[model samples]
Every structure is written in structure tokens, then in C-alpha cells.
Target: MSTFGTLYRVTTYGESHCASVGAIIDGCPPGLELSAADIQTQLSRRRPGQSNLTTPRDEKDLVQLQSGVEQGVTLGTPIGLLVRNEDQRPKDYTETDLYPRPSHADYTYLEKYGVKASSGGGRSSARETIGRVAAGAIAETYLKRAYGIEIVAFVSSVGKIHLPSSIAPPSAVPVNGADDNDDVEDSLSPEFRKLLATISRAEVDKYTTRCPHPETSERMTKRIIRAKDAQDSIGGTVTCVIRNVPAGLGEPVFDKFEAKLGHAMLSIPATKAFEIGSGFRGTEVPGSKHNDAFVRKADGRLGTATNWSGGVQGGITNGEDIYFRVGFKSPATISQAQETAQYDGTPGSLAARGRHDPCVVPRAVPIVEAMAALVVMDELLIQNARKTAAALLPAITTLPPTMVLPKGKQ
Candidate 1:
């Protein structure tokens, strides 16, 4: 199904090479400030032709708000947003009809639909994610205001180049030989704090980008350029961390919070795998070593002695950092020619010709963060609805005789 979520639902439509692609956000809370500009900021980030590291297909990706809001505030109706395709090169894919692109959805789509769009990968294209990113930005805003939750994601690994352990891990790592100090407050001076926050905000505003640490971002950029020069594409891993998520935001049994987040991550194009908390590594350790020990704080709050669980237990947030990793496949459109089959099943060879990212991991960082924000925000809204329902139960129980009616009679 194209729709996501039960209460805070988002239904996306259109294909990559279609005239336009957009989303309808249903169940958005009324009175939330929103505008085309808010959605445009996110679209700009994921738009192509931004830098040498990404595809050279340029599009303005301007957003057109259709309905569900008035005077920049939600009207308690479905929010509809659209982004028209300004640049489309169907000629680039004319040959695709004869031979499917390697590792793309071209063959699969044809098998299902009996025909596929000749321009780009159609619905399978990363362009399909524009609607998702736009809707996610709105979800993120609500989450920040309602729960003080923050989502941060960065490219942690590209191909064989892995982020150094010194940067941190899925679980907090000891720094400067200090232990038991999970809360590492911003140690920068007031001026520096302001500078960093400004930079962080700018990154979020830019949407499809980030530079949490400028030096690191620059270094990563250089590596991507070098990889491109080799005529090869690289895959990498993105690490996302969610902080300040309140407890009881997720349901037990089926609708686990992490499961929803996993579904969202896997939905992104090129995403190959998903992992939470200790993930695969925890399987190697004994239960005693992997389990997070419980500790009671002096303020009477419960905390974990170690965060191997990554702040989640029994599929619910435990008021600690929630972190996960998403792995993306290498870009399939490398320059090197390879032996393959044509559409008629004839043996042949094809060398992809196009402008594509040498490494998608860097650009994928923001997309991962956006999806995480969307999932968390939806959960928050669901929890609020449940809370409101429970609060009214007692009042209903004490209602006057005149107000109370027999179920069948009412």
C-alpha cells in the first residue's frame, strides 16, 4: 500500500518521470503552522544536480500546496503537496526498453505491469522519495514541539571506509577515559555553542544535506570525489540516533516501534539492510554481557547502567538514545560495461551512460533521519490520542443519569 501509518497517514502518488509527484498527509493535527516553503526546503535537499557527488539531472523541485491549510496553519484536513517534474530526459532511457538497467527495478516493474515508463526508473526512482521527505519534515516539526525529541543521522561508513570508533557507536562509547557519563553536554563555549547550533539548523534547513562536524563532512566529500574518479560506485551505512523519545510511544505485540522504523528505512531506494541497538554483534555475546543492566537514579528515574539495548526494551523506548543503522547498496549505474541481456532475452553488453552519485551514503543520511522523524512523530500522535481517550474514561464513568444512555438506545 502507498499509505503509511494508522492515524498520521501519508499517501504518496506519481512516478519518477511523471509530470509530478506528491503526497497527501491525512490526520495532521490542526493549527500546526505549515507552508509551501516548509516542504520546499526538504525537496531541495533530495533534488538532483546539487553537487558533483550526485546525479546531474537538475530540477527546481518547487512545491505547490494544494489544500488542507489556510494562512499557514493546518485546517484539520488532509495536506496535499506537489512537485512538478521540470526536467525529464526520456531519450536517455530509450535504450532501457531494449535492455533493463542492472540492479534496477526496470525488469521487475515490467514483469508486474507488462509495461514500464521509459524515462528514468519511473516509480522505482529515488525521485519518488521527494514526497516522503516533504511529509517527514512536517512530522519532525510536530515531534520537536510535542516531545522535545531530536533526530540526527550521518554517513557512518562508505564502502570500505568506515567511520572511526572515536566518533562514537550505536551505543555511547567512552570518551577521554571517562565512564558512566552518557550525557555529554555540549562542552563548547557560549559562542561556539551558538555557532554549532546555527550550523546544525542550517543543515536541517538544507534538508538533503548535513555537516554536523564540518571537518568530517569535508573529509567525506573528498573521499566521494576520489571514488567517482575511479569509475565505480560505493555503498555505505547511515547511523541515526533519536533522543528524548518518551516511554510508551509504541504498542506491544505487533506494532513495535522499531519494526515501524525498519519498514520506513527499507522503503527508501537502495536501502539493503536495517539494524537496531547491538544488532548482529549482540548475537555473538553471552546474555550477561549483552543485556543492559538497570540502574535507579538519585532523582528516582530509571536508567540503564549500559545502553547495549540502545534505549529500547520490549520494542518500546526506554528514555535513552535510540540508534540504528541503515545500509545502502552501491549505485548501479557505473560507467564500466558488463555483459547482460536485452529486453528480448538476447545476450548483449551495456555500459550505463548518465550522471549518478559515486556514493549515495552521504546524501542518504538526511533521508534516513527524515524517515526516523516521521515514524517517531506518528507514534507520538498515536500515544497522545490514547492518553486523551484514557483521561476521558473516568469522567464518563461518573456521568449523570440524564447524560448516560443505554448503548442500544443511544
Candidate 2:
């Protein structure tokens, strides 16, 4: 279950309090320029202690490029990456060894395996996602270099504070393709795509809340502080947009595009719900309004006049910007004490232990983007294979540089 993807697979290992956490990336293309710096950029973003809104524990998370490359070029072998766990406070979780915390994996992990790690929720900790983010950085590099695909995510809401729809990124397509259009269209404009390309993680980090809209970001940060003072946690949603994805990337039947995206998303810690394109709000709209209009693009490929389908239709990419949202529940561990019983039915009260984020959505931003990268990279590889197979015809089967015909037959 730890292994993910078909061709671009990644297997993660280690736990929150373990000596080190790392990943094995098995399917990266050969000759991609990769380095520890590329992987460290994301690990730093996901590492704790960057802000008051997240866990304050400092994990250097300095990644080591163990193998699979030489002189900065990939060898197309299994790439192994490692990040040592610094400042691990396993002692913070000592109390939970006997009494499993409420709403945590402490109880179920014990039931399923008859034994548990007894620290930092073992493999259930958000710290484990470091491996995923690291692996995803590799996938993202390949996807961008190969397909010009770009993925961006930010905090859309924290508690009840939300970035107003007025300042939200452009959604519907621009009919006139103008930058200052007052009227909204059903599809994205060339102007909007231009704007999306300029966004970067450095720009996102300028705001502590990671919401690109400056005014709303300040508000979200204040709200997180309030929750932290109250010793409680709040839940919120993240909206991600994947732009410049080409057509015909998804697989049909069982391994559809959105299906794989959802599976990867929910696999992350604390994710409760997943939605794509117009998602739930689209449910209220009639089919006439919800359906995307097909218009031939200037590039000559048929494009959508609207993205109500969220860049996907019939379980495949249609050369549009695919957008989606993921909802995360409040972290179950809180500083407030709750009355509960021990595993042996003994009466007790438990206040959660360990360094925990007051709101995970802020830190979850990079995790979401990483998971999205993994899914897209996997699907793109499959699509490439399919395209190559379809091009293999009887007339072309005997071509040079591959199959060679006998001297007389040639």
C-alpha cells in the first residue's frame, strides 16, 4: 500500500520519530538534471518551525541524494533520497504508549497489527509526508521539463476566514482574451494563463498563510493565532490548479485521471474530502450550465469555453487547466483535555501530546501540490507508453534502429 503510481512509482519509509525518513523513486526518466537542492526546496517548505501557525519543532530536513544519479544526471535507476530526523522528541509522546489518544491511529494501528510504534502516531504522522514531497519534487521537475505542466496550490480558507471571490484567481475562460475583462467567460483566457505562469513558491511564502492574496492572507494568519491561543484546532480547504496539461493523459475504465488523484490525495494525513473542477457547487447548476463548451483553440486543438469540468472530461485530460479542492478536518489532537477510557476500559482523561500544528491546512499546501505532481507524472508516463504503442503499426514494425528485417526481406 505504501507504493504509489504505475510507471513513476515511489515507496516511502520511516516514521515521524524515526532516525531518518526517505523515499525510493523507481521510475524517473534518465538524464534529467537533478540534485539535492531541487529536493530540498520542497522539504524546506514542508518542514516545521517556519511559522507560528504550524508546529514549532525545527527539523533541518537536509536531504541526501543517496544514489541513482552521477555528476548531476539521472542514471534511470532507482533514485534513493534520505533526510535525517533532527530534534525528534519521542519523549513528548511517552504518555500515549499506554493510553491511545482519541481520534488518532493509536488505537486502530494496535488493533490491526497487535503492536504499535507508540510515538508520533508512528507512520500516521504528517512528518512522513516529507518523503512524498521529496519524491514529488522529482516528478514535478520531469513534468515541467517534458510537458510544460505547472501546479499551484494555496490556502483558500482558514476556519471561517476565506479569500473573497472578487480577488480569487480567474476561473472561467476569457472570451475576448483580454486582461481587464469585466465580464466572465466559460473558459480560461490567454491572459490568465500568463498570470498563472508567473506565480512561484517564493511569492506564496511572502504571506505566512500562503494565500497569494495579501489582504486575505493577513486575516487567515490572525485567525490561526486565535485558535492557537484557545488551545484548539480548525479545519479548512485548499484549492489547486494544474495548468498546461496536454490532452489524452488520463486512463479509462478503472484507472481514470481523477480517481488516481483522489486516491493520492486521501492517502495524505488528515484529508477528509476531495473535489474536482466545479465540484459540489456545480451540483446546483443545471447540466446546461455545468457542461463545458467545446471551442477550437488558436493552437488548433479543441478547447473548453468553460472549465466547469475542472480540466477533465469522461476521466481524461482535455488540454485545459485542471483545478480541484481538498478538504481537511481539524487535527484530532488538541491541548484541551477530553474524558475518555483507557484501552483496558479504565476511566481516564487525556490531553493530546507531541508538537502539533494548530491548523494543518497551512502546512498541507505543499503536500497537496506534491501528491498532484505524483499523479500527473504517473499518468503522463502511461500516456506516453500508449502513444508509442499506437504508433507501432505493421508497416512501421520493421523500421531501422529497432527491428531489422533479414537481408533478402529488406
Which candidate comes out best when scored by TM-score? 2
TM-score of each: 0.85, 0.89
For model 2, the local distance difference test gives 0.82
Q: Which runs in model 1 stand beyond 4 Å of their true positions?
A: 171-219, 297-300, 395-410
Residue pairs in clash, model 2: 172-187, 173-186, 173-187, 173-188, 186-305, 186-306, 187-305, 277-310
| Tens digit of per-residue lDDT, candidate 2, span 65-114 | 99998999999999998889988888898878667888889899899989
lDDT of each: 0.74, 0.82
Q: Which one is best on lDDT?
A: 2
C-alpha lDDT of residue 54 in model 2: 90
C-alpha RMSD in Å of predicted model 1 compared with the true structure: 7.1
Q: Which ten residues in a row have the lowest lDDT in candidate 1?
A: 185-194
